[model samples]
Target: MKRGWCFLLLWLLTPAWALAAELTGVRSRADAGNVRLVLDLSAPVKYKIFSLKNPYRLVVDIESTHTSKALSMPTTGMVKSVRAGKQQGGDLRVVFDLSSQVTPTSFLLKPQGAAGDRLVLDLGASTTPVKATTRSAGHQPQSKPKPQRSVVTRSVRDQPQRSVVIVIDPGHGGVDPGARGKNGVREKDVVLGISKELARLINKQPGMRAVLTRSDDRFIELSARRRMASKQHADLFLSIHANSFTNSKVRGSAVYALSQKGASSAAARALADKENAADLLGGVDLRGKPDLIKSVLMDLSQNATQESSLALAEKVLNGLSGVNKIHRNHVQTAGFVVLKSTSVPSVLVETAFISNPGEEKVLGSKKGQRKLASAIFKGVQDFVELDMALRLANAPSRPEISYEVRPGDTLSQVAQRYQVSLSRLRSVNSLRGDRLLVGKKLRIPTVAGI
Candidate 1:
């Protein structure tokens, strides 16, 4: 009886992490000089990978994971052979013998549709011999090779600026096919077509890149769409959607920014409620999402971000005016879940009322989609240029020294004494006249490093 009690105590004291995750299967695909290996998992697991020299092998160690007996290995391409063994402390180690020295890239993907959690590893042949290096899961191994200098030289002023990333989201898909028109045109189909065209146009411009939340007909949660924009460090977030009304006569385009203090109008409030219900229709549970409410509250304090969003909405509204009838001449505000991003300026563009037969036909046609995409692109271009100008104007330059004017001091004298241009000094101080009043502060700009 005492031995039985002791066994029970030992079992109860064991840690929950002692339970292992199962590595269900292994699959591989081979190309000309590269090989891709996919490991199917019953649950997500922590992993580490490293290269081995002198026989050239790659080792992968997954923590608290056990390999299934049916797991298979590949024998072709960069990988010559594969072996699996148990490591200390309930870890599984898989080693790959390579035919040649290779660089490895890896990433973990969450479960989607019929697939489970997956760990993907890609091995590519390297020209030079590789040094053994260790890396955590989903990270590329760092190379020790020194960077080479460019053959051509250029001035610092000639360097290109960083590209602005814009995240485009097409609303509703899959089971939740948004609004439908009399002609059988679905909102999902129309907005996706327009979003793709917008992405194409934005990519063609210099110093701008576009990323889509969903390129296909997949339903993404409203909060997830905003999170995607934040993940991309996006400068702007545009949610493309087609509006619908109970009355088929209502037809026009509209732009909206998020407002924490209720909607601007009754129609805007109803639309926001309809849009927010998409999560429930798409089977997304919002019960445990306190972060969503927190994000909305946080956005309320972000006045600069809200102002930028309003400015962006105005520009997009102006652009829409050129393509179709304006639903509202001014930009509207509502409590849209997708526009609650705290950092990125976000807006939702109602392309047109899908319920209207006349606009539905235009939305379904290729020519109409292109025209709308072009208008939105033009608006985005205008906003980006204006934003860039404001940033440049506000950017810190050469330091300035505060000088109080004396009885006989002149503006030109201060400019000359500081070795700064008189015009630049006048511009910096916003002085319309050159006369300096005694006892008044004068900002004298100084050259950097002088």
Candidate 2:
């Protein structure tokens, strides 16, 4: 009787001894702008998820969980690959390598019928929805539900528009401590201080959002910095840096835009060469890319982008003149790798010369940083206002009417009938002469008053 009772007690305690959750399988799917990852487990597990930059990645750590074998899942959307491994104390760790930054959310699903305990992760852009899969698990086979809702919510008439996004980058971080001043002030630290102040001021303004490439002391690749701005759909990309010179006497601030041809001056060429060399220290591999590919990439800077960059640079330079000495009266042009963004208007602002003794003191002080930040913020405000005004002016205020020419209709007759000037009608229709072709459609300009 005693032996039978001891055996029953041992059997009852077996489950308590083996309480670790087992990860069974993993699966992933992706839609237009979002990705969904599901993890099947034997029991509910405590887990945490976080994001890491510098070649963006998402990490999932599950406590008191173990996987019998390596876990692998297909990559989709922003995710480039998935990796799983065991951590200290037998915890399961899964990592997702991503091509771009994403907003991540996770939740645990209770067991229901045939479905076991599961964890689901949703990754997507900020403006897109991620709860589509979570809310309708039973309707996975149907495609109509998600698209109809997405279309309706995205319509301009239904929802309010998003604000303009501005990405600010602080140059030189981590092991690569850019030019140091005599007082032991680092360029990276100074620029970060100024960038943070600028971001703070920008956030207080209405209809403007600010994003920093690196909010902390982390090293980010030059190419990845620009990619971040593009992924965020940024309207403006501003890189903040403290300048240095061989002559410690050089003191002033300057602004630069990307130049397709060459540097604007000899000094600008030397500075560009110096800044471009930072890639080597940051561990950027250019060996895989061919010369032809590099040439093609350089040619991607379109005329419209260049013009906008120069306009922004000029405004920023003008603002800097009020706070500090102007190094170059005009906006300088350089082949800066950071300013090579094809779509977003990009500019590099040299806040002040860190090598100069007097300027270094100002760059390192909090009050001076605030002043510099205010100047840059004012410049951005000016640029945004001017850009908005230009867009409004270029946009058609009234609807244009198309009129088909009749057998006896003349250009002046049509203009008179439409209550518009003949010259305005000719210009709107791109007419070279007074003659009008029959059966041809002419666009009539809607003049307020004739």
Which candidate gets the maximum TM-score versus the true structure?
Answer: 1
lDDT (Cα) of model 2: 0.74
State how far residue 132 of model 1 sits from its true place (Å).
Answer: 49
Q: Report clashes for each candidate as comma-separated counts.
A: 0, 0
* Structure candidate 1, residue pairs in collision: none
Q: What is the lDDT of residue 148 in candidate 1?
A: 19
| lDDT over C-alpha atoms for residue 365 of model 2 | 96
- Model 2 clash pairs are none
Q: Please state the error at residue 327 of candidate 1 in Å.
A: 1.0
- Name the candidate that leads on lDDT: 1
> Hey, what RMSD does candidate 2 come out at?
22.8
CA lDDT of every candidate? 0.75, 0.74
